[model samples]
Target: MKQQTKHSDARRPLMAADQSGQGARQDEDASKRSWGSEQLAAFEDRLRHLRLTPSQQSLASVVLDNPQQVAMSTIHALAGELGVNESTISRFTAALDLSGYAELRSVCRALANRYSGMLWRFMRADHGAEADSESGANRSQGDGKDLAGKNGTSGQRERRDILAAQDSSSIAASFARIDGVLWDEVVTRLGHAEHIAVIGLRQSQAVAAMFAYLLGLVRSQVSELSAGGARYLDALRDLGPHDCLFAIATQPCSKDTVNVAQWAKSHGVPVIALTDEVLGPLAELADQVLIAGTESDSVLSSMTAPVSMVQALANDVAAVDAAGTRAHLERQEALLKSFGAYADKDL
Candidate 1:
């Protein structure tokens, strides 16, 4: 049975898109920017999947309803409002993987910043805004220093430096979590699979399709799963031990995504999951799980690391069968030219 949140209708299609990449990619990227909304959706999913005590459920409702207020309130105040002891509040935070009230406040603040579209701006201004020496008013120190202190500290240059640092940290985190041997095994299997089906629901659709398109360029047995209806299950039914199901999902992961992965695993089909956190429902089901870093100080989380991983796998596959891969590309190019598939020389 598939589990769905009480607010599924509102969130299910928030990340869902049509088969076209040009339009879908735009929407997917936009959805990824709403980190606060995504957090609430994830909480809903957790509520559905995990058994919760009545007090915990009530506490969650209050937290979700007014996270900003919770951020301003002390533990004693919250406990008094809920008619619960302070120890109960402490236990609640622990259950949610938070350390204590302070950590809870930090999370709420971040989410509030996300909702207000001020996280990145606030962070940049925190360090970049300098008090005017004469007037004592706050002003951007655009000429203080550069990232390396060698160039002028223009606001644009400082922002670029901060974003670049974030990118570096995220890529490092991905590499740290990824197991080289496990990834190589997945790549080797993909190279030899008789058929390959890529599954990604909601925001992940764009990623899964991009992966399939890239693999298709090098080989001929790849297909992106459709979200139409029961037909998706039929596609899964057709898959066997010789086929591979590549799935991509991220935080606030969909329940339907987990269902398909579970089905494939139970049927003895190999499953590969690309996701953010190191441990989750999808990770438990996948034979090879790749963890990608989605952390960011800005509005949108970056997918550069995950996309790079997919590209690497495709490159390795091409390398494994160099002659065949070259022939495939040649045939594809010839067909494109013959059919006038490209718009112009620029294409």
Candidate 2:
């Protein structure tokens, strides 16, 4: 079995933003946390357990809601946005036992990467050597024991456990990153849009088409943007303020989809993005972004989290107008029956 390397220590600090005297005027902590302990997941765990005053919690809320801003913005800019004094910001970091705002910002920067699709590079264990050794029948039930040691279960069982763990963790992480307010706003936009377009390309098309189909069952104007050549652009070109573009994009993200999303945003159309990254291109263009984790134990990325998000979004849209959705579904059911869409027999 191959050993996995711990690469957290090697992670480079994100480029620091320009600082000004107006940012913060406090001294650094004497017992500040080491940069090594500043890994994102651990930092988030600390955030969970750390007791906070009401003011600190409020400041934390602003950070939680806009991690990227905290990562990229100067302390002065952040203080201004939150309408809090620079000292209050310093106090908030102090409560977290951070050295100062600089350390806090570094953790935020790492977190932004984690919420985006890039964390797999940092989180996933090295499996390349194992992939080579385990080829064909030479691989026995020893792989799990390889990971869990000699006393552990067979390789097959261990593999199952690893995969299951990855799936569960990915799903939990996906839900954890969701901002309820953003979700509400997205659902509201979808409910009110005169036309809703779901655009996806390549691997993303499956989830996009599924979402569009589910949405169409309850709404009058929902479409999965066709890949039928230039006509896709024609469909996007027609969008306006009354319309919404619900884009489903995953890694290896489509340029066309990003362009269309940006184009719609410029045209006053609300764009809702269900994607894998927090700082992904689509997220940047989207008015509302819902993160869905794509990490997997295997080389190929998982769509489980993304699909679950879509299902939740569909249910929310249905809830927005329960009576109207019920009527529309009933009408569609009647039409399907009239057309004999389903066979009379089970066959």
- Give the TM-scores of the predictions, in the order they appear: 0.58, 0.60
Model 1 spans > 4 angstroms off: 1-160
| Each model's total of backbone clashes | 1, 2
Model 1 scores a TM of 0.58
User: Per-model C-alpha lDDT, please?
Assistant: 0.65, 0.67
Superposed Cα deviation of residue 223, candidate 1 (Å): 0.7
Cα lDDT tens digits for candidate 1, 1-347: 12111222322222222336754564445334334667756753453344446676556645543355455455655676667887777787788766465556555545544543244434333443221222222222223332222235575576576667767777776776556677678778889998999988876778888899999999988988877678788888799999999888875576888998998898899998888744457876788888776654444556777777787788888877888899999999999999988788665
Q: What lDDT would candidate 2 get against the real structure? A: 0.67
lDDT of 2 by residue, 1-347 (tens): 01111222111223223334532332133214344434555665565455665556556644543366577555666676657787888887887777677778766755555543344322323432332233211111113222322224566686667667777778887877666777788888888789999998877899999999999998778988976768878888788899999888887578889988888888899888888755467876787778787755453567888888888888899989999999999999999989989876856
* Cα displacement (Å) at residue 78, model 2: 20
The worst-scoring run of ten residues by lDDT in candidate 1 lies at 1-10
